[model samples]
Target chain A: MELQEKLKILADSAKYDASCSSSGSNRKSGSGVGNTAIAGICHSFASDGRCISLLKILLTNCCIFDCKYCLNRKSNNIKRAIFTPEEICTLTLNFYRRNYIEGLFLSSGIIKNPDYTMELLIKTIFLLRNKYHFNGYIHAKAIPGASPKLLKKLGLLVDRLSANIELPTENGLKLLAPNKESKNVSQIMEYVKINQSKKYVPAGQSTQMIIGATKETDLQIMSKSANLYNQYHLKRVFYSAYVPINKDNLLPSLEHPPLIRENRLYQADWLLRYYNFKVTDLLDVKNPNFNILIDPKADWALRHLEEFPKEINTCSYNELLKIPGIGVKSARRIISSRRNFTIHLEDLKRMGVVLKRAKYFILCNGKYITNKEFFNKKFIERNVMLEERSLIPTNKEQLRLF
Target chain B: MNNIYIYDGDFISLLNIILYLLKNNLHPENIKTDVYHPSLFENTIYLSILKNEKIIDQIISAFGQYAMRSMYYVFLSKEENKELILYYFFQNALKRRHKIMYYHNLKCVSEVLRISNYVRHETHKMKGFLRFKELEKNILYAEMEPTNNILFLVSCHFVNRLKNEFWVIKDNKRKIISIYDKKQFVIVKEEEFKLSQKESKGEQNIEFLWRIFYKTIGIKERRNERCRMNFMPKKYWKYITEVKEEL
Candidate 1:
């Protein structure tokens, strides 16, 4: 097969992995071809609105295991291709030189077995680093059930490493991917966690969980993510909405991918990581799923109405973060700006705060931006929903506005 | 006298004029660049451009390092009345000392912060969206048309990242180009240097493969052109290799 044909096949299969970030490690290119930016750079955006930061491709699409939710399952009749170690190195080096990609994100289907697949991945990455003298960012997938020695070596070479927890619950894994086990995924995470040091996976490890796959609630997904953060010291937990690809009874059949749910999960995940909010604070058993209308943060603010009208000028950093529109930067700006001058409501927009959502929650110098009647829970919820109404998919056929 | 001070559009010259006026306590009606339009009643004073090495240090010591950075970024901006904005920003920053940056509520301070943020945002976007095409003898060339004068800022990042390769980044809006010779880079105003893109062999094939990879990587079900345009604006599509006519 031609190299272009193989690239299209492998890249198409690898698109489902969903972790495209090339951040968290600052590798210098001293007398080398390229270097890694600490903050990461997205070379381009794909049609699906995902950032194309890395040369994301599979080493091969030929699989040994048959996972029902996956498009690359063994039973599926699709064009299969495998790239040689030399081909991957040349492609990554050429692409890097052209400023087309930040680095390579190499994952593979189970070519023969776990060990065999991992060795091919390691060989490609090693050739890219040593043979090609490419010192840019590399994110490699840690194949489940791979040996500890190989996993450790892979971690040492790459900037970031991830082993995906494909489903939020083990029950989902058993139902959809009967051949796979969550234990193998955790084993890879545990190995990387134990062996991780300054040089070994300096960007730390991350994992992904497929949302809306097998009846797992947002609460369960977030709870699992929180557990992963506490247990694995992961950098990011990516949430990919389940796009129905196969004609199987095991997977949830959907016309459109549950993108809204996936977006809500990400908002909640950010709350967990940055906003210092617990899973319980955002969701409970009663409210298992996120309100498809408002974001998780605004939803939390509405449920706790007693916290409304916090004085923005005198509020602490943590208090400012709890308000609907104030983000980390805007919150910091508010605290710093208020030191020099009193922050009126109009000044919040200039400081990067989204006043549309924050105005319902905060006050300036003990005076509400709107009347006190607008502070009621129902009114705030209606307004917030209206603000986010554009994001909601209008219908099955209509195109969305930019 | 309603004197309008005009200095060559250089950061140091702007600083010198501001300092000269402040030292003599001559509050000019406005401070503009050489590109200013004369009003009906105007007394325009053209000041010669000279590098004042101590002015930068003075500003740093008086208002702090952050103030100096904001002032420089505001100077690089393409905003209207940028000179007067910088003058007001520097004056307020000096009075408020190091704590001036925190005064986002103040009009002068906020204007400086906003324009600097705009420049920084463009610099970041250019770092990602700028695509390089391989020329003869392994030289990479790229072109951009950013609103702000961000050629120097973006070149600094590429100098360290692509240190072992020869590359040229041209800012078409400002008619400036950054040339890096595998070790260091220099930014110069070049209006007449023709860009001869002698393509290396197999470069087209590599770009074709990239376009294929970009087309195939996106999930078909989640094809949102709006979202893609939001991140990578439509204005940048002219130079991006992957965003072809079909996409």
Candidate 2:
């Protein structure tokens, strides 16, 4: 088959894997044909809003395992092609010279066997770096169940490595990707983490979790992610919203895409990483899911109104960050601006602080500004919920309010 | 009166003349002449020859200390409203020893500074954004006509990144290449240069592959037109092979 035909099949197959970032690599231009920049280049954005920085393709679209979510599942009827190691190397160098892409993102299905697929992927990277002198970013997927020796060798050559968890829970994995086990995936992640700390995988490791595929609650997902972060030291835990392509009796046939939920999860993820908020703090067993009407931060603040009326003058950086509208940038600005002069309500507004939401929780100088009559915990909660619902009247909000 | 101080359209010579006027505490309006006929100014005056290195150094130092650093570039670009900038510089320069320094706070000065800074940042960003594809001639050709003076800044990055390989950064607008030899650099005007041979089937095939790769990788479900445009502007679409192929 022609190289273009192989690229189209492989690239199309690999598009669903959301780990195509060319960032975090410090590989400078050596006496080589290509160079890698720290700020990962985005060659283009796909229709899915993800940036395509690398020539993301698969070694082969032919798979032994039939993962239900994957387009290359054994049962699915799609034309398949595999590129030779030499073909991939030649294409990479040609593309690199033309300024088409910064690097290559190579991921493959279980072609023949895991070890066979792993060997082919490793050979491609080796050829690119050694023979082709391509120093650009190379992100290779660690095929699950590949030997420890193969995985280690793969880690050294590529800038970043990933093993998709595929699904959040063990049951989810069992249902969707029965051949893959959650423990084996986590074990590989643990290996990647240890190597990364010892300067093995300098770009670090990331894994993807398929959201809404299983009946797992948001709390469960967050707790799992927190455990993954703590235990494995994974750089990122990507949450891909499950899009049912294959007709299965087990899965629900949703009319609309779960984009809003996916967006909310990303917001929740940001709160966990940057906002210094815990998963349990964001949601509990009783309220096990995110309130889609408002963002995770706003929802949390509204629930805990007693923490509010925070003094802008005296509040610590941490205290200021806890407010809904105050992000890292705004929080730093507030800290710096306060040193020059005492801040007022209007001053915050001028600094681009969202006073509409912040007004209820904060005080200019030990004074309640927004609706003093609703200063109590219940009244504040009610008012905030009303405000949230007014903004976005979700079905859940409609049912609760009525 | 909107008095224009026209230079000989040469950067270094214009810099030297501006330094001479600045050292004498003379505003642009005070002296001018018709050096170059069609672009001549009636009030222009030819600056006296100051061959002494020390005096030249003092004048350049004063220019740096008094004149708005970036406004000089704007002035060289022959942008409109050059007199107001010169007027503001003179007014500020006369108030203090380096009074023109105060005019650095003017809106035009800030705009120039902002533009220069943006250009510098974008050039740095392009160092990462640049994707070089090899041609049949073994020439590692990559064309980038950035929105700023990114050619110089990007050249520094390319020099370090491709230390082993000789390459050129062709500015499509200026038709100049910042070509680097082993240890030295020179700008070559390649007005007649075509990027690829018109009949090169290999180049056309590669272009086809790039377009396929670009189109196939983009996820149809999550298309953010704004974010896409923000990173890869439409103006740059002409130079980008993949984008051009798609169009």
Candidate 3:
């Protein structure tokens, strides 16, 4: 097959993966072809709202496993093409010089076997590093059940490694992808965590689970993510809303990807990483899903209204962060700015805190300036939901942690 | 005492002006700095801040190297009050002795931070948004008109990434260009050039495939122009390879 044809098939197959970040690696240029900036860089955003940072393509579209939610499942008859290690290196160098991508994001179906596919991936990275002298950021998928020896060697070469947990629960895995196991994903994550100090996956490990694919509740997914984060020390847990690509018995045939749910999960994920929200603080078994009407932080604040009317002047940084609209940066600003000035509602506005949501939750100089009806749950929900409905977000960067 | 001072807008010159102001114990409000804007008044001292090594060392030690570099970036911004902002920050820094950089609540410190943020953010954005075309003589060329005076700030990043490749980044708006001859970037005023082969046939082939790949990957179900505009603003869309086809 021609190279263009092969790239189309491979890139089409790989697009479903949705991990388009070339971040976290501070690999500087030192007699090398490229550099990885610390915070990462997004080269382009596709019309689908996905980032095109790296050349996120598969080695080949051929697979041995038939994961039901996947586009390149073994049963589906699709075009398959494999790029040689030399081809991979040549393409990456060409693209890097042309400023087309940050680096390579090499993923593939289980070609023949896990070990065989991993060998091809490892060889490509080895050639790119040793022969081409490319020092750009590379985020490669760790083939599940690949030997720890190969995994360790490959881990050293790439900036970041991931073994996607595909589904949140063991039962979800069993139902959708019978051949794959959640344990297999965690094992590699555990391996990467152990080698973090040794510079194995220096950008740290990340994983993804397809939301809305399984019957698992939002609470279950969050708990699972919390367990994965706590146990494996993963840097990010991406939640890809299950974009139905197949007509299978196990898959959910939906008209659209659950983008709003995905966004909410991203918000919740942000809260977990940045804010002091534990998984339990956001939701419980009784409330399995987030209230889609408002954001996770506002939902949490409204539920715990007794905690509202907190004085901004005397509140701790942690307390400031818990309020609906105060993010990490703004909270720190509040802390530093309040040290010099007696903060009022006017001062809070200057600090870039979301005064619309925060007005319901905070007090400045013993004054609650917002409407008195804000004390009621329905009224608060209506106001907050109205604000959310109006927020037609101009841009949300594609290389998001969630 | 109200003799207005003019300055060429570089950090070294700005520092020299500050050094003279400090030595004279004159308030900075009596002075002004602009990048060669013609002054209406006569007898005004065009601030001749020279590259004196001894004073450079003194300035470095006084503000710390990070602050000096940051002040340079902040000055590069389109801030009208940049001179006054940097002056007040320096005045406070010299007074408090290094405590002023961390004093974010101060108006001078916050204003400096805001200007630095603009320069820093644009430099980072240019790192990604820049699109290079394969030209003749084995040269790579990327043309942009960034919002800030960010060409010099972002040059080092590209040089590091494409170390062994000869390339040039042209800032169409500022009429300045940086030429990287596989080692270091040498920025010059923008110059005109013709395409060597107009468009190499091989280059066209690769460009064709790139345009195709860019189109195929966007999931039609999840199309959001607002989100895309947020990342790759409309200003950059004219030159970006894949998105250009749509326009």
True C-alpha contacts between chains kept, each model in order: 0.86, 0.56, 0.60
DockQ of 2: 0.32
Report how far off residue B133 is in candidate 3 (Å).
1.9
Q: Judging by lDDT against the true structure, name the best candidate.
A: 1
> 1 or 2: which has the higher DockQ?
1
TM-score against truth, every candidate: 0.97, 0.78, 0.91
The order by descending DockQ is: 1, 3, 2
Question: Number of clashes in every candidate structure?
Answer: 0, 27, 0
Candidate 2 lDDT over A1-402, as tens digits, reads 888788888888888787778888888676787677776776666545567778888889999988777789999999988899999987787776666677888889899888889999999898888887788888889998889999998998888899988777888889888788777787789888767743467788989987776788888888888888888887788888776777777676654346567767888888888888999889997999887766888788878877877998889999998997788877876786676467777667655578877777888877778768776767655666667665442433245435
TM-scores (chain A) of the candidates: 0.97, 0.90, 0.95
Residue-level lDDT for A167 in candidate 1: 90
What TM value does model 3 have? 0.91
Put down candidate 1 lDDT per residue, A153-251, tens digits, no spaces: 898889999998899898889898888889999998887888888799999999998887789888899999999999998999999988989988777
* DockQ scores of all models, one per candidate: 0.84, 0.32, 0.58
Candidate 3 residue lDDT tens string, A108-142: 88998899999999998999999988998899999
Candidate 2 off by > 4 Å: A197-199, A309-313, A340-402, B1-117, B124-136, B142-145, B163-166, B173-176, B182-201, B223-227, B245-247
Best prediction by DockQ: 1
Q: Is candidate 2 or candidate 3 better by lDDT?
A: 3
Candidate achieving higher DockQ, 2 or 3: 3
